[model samples]
Target: MRDAPLEFVTAMAAHGDVTRHDADGEPVYMLHRPDLARHVLKENGAAYTKDRTPDDDMLRPLLGNGLLTSNGAEWAAQRRMCAPAFRPAEVDRFDRVIVEAAEHLVAHWDGGRPVRVDHDLTSLTLTVIVKAMLGTDIGVAGEGFGRAVDAVNRFIGHYVPSDDPDPADTAARYAGFHRARTFLDRVTRVIIAARRAGGAGDDLLGAMLAEGHTMSDADLRDQVLTIIMAGHETTAKSLTWTLYLLDRNPEAARAVHAEIDEVLEGRSPTAADLPRLRRCRQAVQEAMRLYPPVWLISRRGTADDVLDGYDVPAGSLVCVSPWVLHRDPRYWAEPDAYRPERFDPDRAARLLSHQYLPFGGGPRICVGRHFALVEATLVLAVILRGLRMELVAGFPVEPEALVTLRPRHGLMMIPRPR
Candidate 1:
């Protein structure tokens, strides 16, 4: 499971929609059917808690008790506090930030050389989140924050829970983790201090800061870090995979380019144009279906329950994986193929509940879903209209199932100006 998580999960899904396995003497239940997902993520979501899950164990060290790690009333309050800023109208105001960031990346690309676009997109997204949500330019802090996240991702990428571990390797990994954590902590404090002095604005960070009387500086820091990690990292990987999939399927690429050409007509897209950029939207949606950024959603059952006739005992590790669910033949046609039309608005609306959850389902659905889709669509339009990325031959692309599913080797591609 540690070395090849995708294969392991895929094999498990093949056995049955609901399968039970033993992991170090603990029960791990995998649910693949859509109704089962609905049952676990929605109907009985209260009975399941993120506490003690792998995600909680790995991220709580860095994310603290932010939305991702908190439970019960705390989580609800954080969600309510953070909700206003991500409302569709509020997110629409960030469109300029998203477009400008993408335009900056397009202007910087050297058409003559191969670029590691995955890395570049990561930086671009960091800039967007910092400027749009945090209410400040990334400036000097952006580079260090990017490095810190990369180091943290590297550490988490190789992490596997264990009773006994190698002392030397564990020490090395924790050394880097602590270094990253320290840098993140320092930068977060500086941002909070600077933002507080200026008074809170209307962005996500500002929204949180507006309620500062109720939250400690440490609490604010945790939420800020959570937004940074959840906001930027996941969107960056989604864009990277969207481009990779387009490169893999020329027909889809041509369709996307045609739609962009028709929709923009040589002008940069605005938030208003989002609804009209159907193909661009569909392509991103399809790409996520194939390689969701948050591939696995894990929780621990707080009480015993029967899901689809399978008994899930309290203290068991329950899994709802988009990676497995998206490909289930029960919900998708040609599940292995890259077909963007599967998300054509009419067809998309008909998809069964919980069958296509790139942003997840239930009350815990990503608060930034609208923000991410708008950013992804506009940025994708910008890239497809301005340049063409060709995968460098023999550059092996495999999904590394870490905290986020990322291309194992950074996506190496040659850019040709459109």
Candidate 2:
């Protein structure tokens, strides 16, 4: 019973699985055991669904039964319709879009001044996702969307069940959520309308429309909103975290640059160069293990189940946190160290299933995994080729547990000319 909240949860994880009584006094199981987490996420995945808490409801207005939050038949249908859009070939098609965005970001960097790396990464990814997914220019809409995301992150970070009603606070939270949703809704609707008007061309939205599914305005908005939010935030954090790690680990950063230099020789990275950027990909993978974006994944059991000798009732809230599992000593050697060699193809090939769940597992695993990896790798290569970053003195980087793991204070760093 510590006074702090998230620290208590993090400490509880070091031991075996811990169950806490929620606001309703119902037991919510937090599985810190890596093997058990693997069992539930991969081996026994069929027993769980993603609708674990009111968080889904909070996002429902904007996502509107989209694949990310939808369960059962709706999830299946959305997955089927959008699966092709994220296929390896389709994701490769967005390489130029990602490279272009990276170049645009690099062009704005001032080597003379300290820059907030977090903001730059977010803006870059948002621009790339908007162009690649919808074939639309959301440059004007990005500022509002970024603010809304900040508001949403703040809301999720400080979330606690209310024991007594405070009307002003409640109204403000709801207002913030709605404002964020409205911003995304406007962008999504415009993209959908443009696609319908034959402007999407060869982008993902165009492919979705060509599939012959007559989605209503609301449904289309939700799907687009979900993709845009997830597409930008997750990969942006991945790159941000990678940069943080690189600043501290110069040798690892050098290895990555060497790989890129040998592979591309200063040309922009294309899909074919992705495989050649092995060290860069490993660096990103290791960074994710150290600072995963989607740190905690929650689910609710649809039926009673026993996982690793613990009884989980039909309505139990089950959380399998990658933040804990990725660093489990039983699975990783030198768990706290930043070592990209762990993900080397030869090494990773021998790992047990579910040992590394950066993108999750099972049927409901993130459909955007390929997309995120491509975007992260390309951005990493592009940045390293042009500039070098060093951690700023006296600027503390602390992980803030929100819907994703972001820096509490902005990630400030100094960019020196390479």
Candidate 3:
């Protein structure tokens, strides 16, 4: 359990559907079965709560009481208030912002050079999320926000056990996190202030302000950071992996491009165009199946109960890793292969609700799920129109399980003119 933090997801596969680990003296259950995963995350959700372990404590300071970390009435309130902004209808209205950000990324790309696809997409998604959610540009932010996120995640990646970390090392990590949070805090405060001064508009932040929703200074900062970082990192990594997979399979790439050409017709796409881009959506779905950004989720059992007829003791931590479940032979045929057609409308509709959880399930499902799909689909359509990205030969794609599933050293790829 302690030795292979990066391989935790894959290592669990060597065990059967359910395996138990001794955390201190207590037993923690890692359930790979989709049915039990659904039971824990959705069906009998009340029987469990977010595991309030030290790992989560590490994020509380950075995230505060935002929706991602908060529980009970607090989480409910924040989720309800923000839900309006992330709904499909609302996300559709932000099409212009999404396209504009994609355009901005193209302008900055060093054409025909080997670009760090992961870092580039991080910048692109960060820009899109900021503009859509806050109605602001990240101009000259110089990829600082993404760097800050990486710094904190790298610190957290030291998921290794310690009787106590070296005092100096602890201090360094805390200091580093402080610097990153300070930057995000400053950015969030500016957004809040700008919204206040300018009256109000339809941006998510402005809409909240317009509705007279209020929070303490700290809570607002947390919400701002949560909205931006959560939306930014997941969508970026999904795009990076999608491109990586497409590069490895030219047939699929050609199909994706043909669909893009047919549906978009050499014009910039809109929210209306998204519904007709079936192949584009299928590719994104299959990509998510292969490398879901939020790869692992866990909840501590609140009561002694039976899940799928197995005893789940009260207070035991139960993990549901989508990484394993998506690859489970039980739910998928040729799970490891990149087969976008597996998600064609008829087949996708036939999949069991519990089996496909790229965005998670049940009440506390990701708030930005709709926004992410819309954003990812649009980014792929626009980017493929002008460039064909290929992985540099021999570039290692190491899957690092951080706050999101990231390619450890960043995905290096070359963008050739289409």
Candidate 4:
């Protein structure tokens, strides 16, 4: 199980478009083929739901019935209520906050010292998310929050096992998971309570309070916790992998820095600058293709369905692995190579539709997609503007599959003055 699951999935993908595996004698289908994924994600999405028992059971206590783990009417209601907050205008409002956080992060980096890029990116992204979404001083809350997140990941890693659960292990896992959740919940509740007492003071949380969409304290708690847990780690992991790829491929890194230099010059990046940061965005896209933090998106069929000549019974578990599909030779050329140019507009147009599932697809696609792109591009621009990085000698950056894909060993790199 220590072996990277993406590697196994990619190898299997080379043999067939889709493959089936048995987990604890329960049949599960892995959809690595792009067309098949599209069929399930796009065409037949409504017939399926994001309701998987093991995942839901594991995450439910932490996320509650929030959008990431909720299903049916509950999901629809929350999605409708929360969708406005991620609109173009609202997301654009986050630009300055994101840049400010990035600037603060850059100010603290010791350029001459070897640093764990993954840890740095995670800290930076978490700060941005907290400021932009919650309007909280996460720099103050960051240490405890980071520890809780790490504990949650460690708990999930141990808990997601195939063997029949041991009572002791089960009890320990529950304790760890709930402890993390309780810590996050305390942070979330304090914010919510402040908002209720009219102290939110002109931020997303304040806006959410004004809307009054979440009437129940339980609902608000779940939504706030969901965003904090779901948004921060995924975006951080994406940036970590992007930097890792760039460090190994200097040519691509050079192109990215050049694009940033030419496009934004000394000015901080904004939503308007996103179009000019096309190369930067492409590099991040390619990185996500290679290492999508949400590598495998699992769903369950609500009814019997036939997909690409395979019968999928109702209640069947279907996993669509972007890590495999993104590297399929049928859709990509030299799939293993780091080539951001493939995503250039003219070149990208030639690729098959639905070939890329970096953020999944269809109605259930990531709502924070635009927000993430803007944040990552802005942060990348800020980081490149003042610093250059080199991979640390002989540091093995292996992939660790957890709730998200992270470096098995932290990403250590040498940063130098630009």
Top candidate (TM-score):
1
lDDT of 1 at 307: 82
Q: Which tens-of-lDDT digit does each residue in 28-101 have in candidate 3?
A: 78887877888888889988877485436556768877878888788888898899899899999989888877
Give per-residue CA lDDT, model 2, range 126-200, as digits (tens): 998888877888878787888888787766555555653677887888799778767777777877887788754
Error of 3 at 185 (Å): 1.4
TM-score of model 3 (CA atoms)? 0.95
For every model shown, the clashing-pair count is 0, 0, 0, 0
Model 3 steric clash pairs:
none
Order of quality (TM-score): 1, 3, 2, 4
Q: Compute the lDDT for candidate 4.
A: 0.79
Residue 370, candidate 1: C-alpha displacement in angstroms: 0.7
Question: How would the candidate models be sorted by lDDT, starting from the highest?
Answer: 1, 3, 2, 4
Off by over 4 Å in 3: 51-55, 164-171, 211-214
- Which candidate gets the maximum lDDT versus the true structure? 1
How would you encode candidate 1's per-residue C-alpha lDDT over 343-414 as one tens digit per residue? 887898899999988898988899999989999999999998978889999999998888898998889988
> Local distance difference test, per candidate?
0.89, 0.80, 0.82, 0.79
Question: Comparing candidate 1 with candidate 4, which one achieves the higher lDDT?
Answer: 1
Pairs that clash in candidate 1? none
TM-score of each: 0.97, 0.93, 0.95, 0.93
lDDT tens digits, residues 135-193, model 4? 77665677778878887886765434555357787778779878887888898898788
Better of 3 and 4 by TM-score: 3
Model 2: per-residue Cα lDDT at residue 213:
57
